[model samples]
Target: MAANKAKRPLPSAQPMRHNPNPQQILRPQYGLRISPAGSQPQRSRLHARETAQLMPVKAHVYRTIAELNGGFEKVIQDLQTLRQISFFRNDRVTAMHDLICRVRAQANRDFTMTLHGRELANAGHFDGLCIEWEKQIEDRSDT
Candidate 1:
């Protein structure tokens, strides 16, 4: 005999709960391959030396240039602040102070790089010409 206890209902299993894989919502080309999506991706097993060899040194130089540019901005900020509360003995001294401040303030640019950046600037123009020529010949049959 039960001692005034209310019995809890057992959860009913749905048909879908037993199915191992869910349905693919998208078509083949638009979505991931089934096995790969369900499994862990293959990882590179490179050592530290190998990884460094594979890394782009140019990209690191670019990043360092960016960091240096940021540091230049902080220095410029300090120089500007110093100018606002500067003391000078003579007109020449004050003029020197102003010149120093101006140079420091001018140093804050978006980036500094080993590259002149001229080739990079012309790169887009070259790409555009290439694309235009390709389009012109894209529809033509080979001779």
Candidate 2:
């Protein structure tokens, strides 16, 4: 019975597969970093600050220019640009309107100043003419 027993083959061992290219190995490279889960992502704070600083001007600068230069044309152009930005909303539009009002006020002040200047010039010219007429009359009466 021992001589008749069948021999069994042992299980074959298989070799582990690995990448042959060294570059395929996962390792930290220059300018690259791994962040832990729930940690803040790497970002440029200066760039963010600059973008934050620019957004307000990009959003509102045209209206400010219009106010200082006294024109709704600039405000209209600003609205056109503002419409293209997804983030600008009703608040910005309302601010633009307020700026338009301010521009109108500035224009009114400029017009008033011009009118007053012209009126003063006319009054001065009239006074000069009166003085000349009085001098001519005094000379005629003395002769």
Off by over 4 Å in 2: 1-90
Write down the lDDT that model 2 would get: 0.56
> CA lDDT of 109 in candidate 2?
82
Q: What are the per-model numbers of colliding residue pairs?
A: 0, 0
Instruction: Please give each candidate's TM-score.
Output: 0.29, 0.33
lDDT of 2 by residue, 1-143 (tens): 13423333223223346656665344333333457878754535644443333312132333443344544555666676676678878677768877777777787688557656665665665666689799999999999
What candidate 1 gets wrong by more than 4 Å, as runs, is 1-57, 84-143
Candidate 1 lDDT score at position 140? 77
lDDT of each: 0.48, 0.56
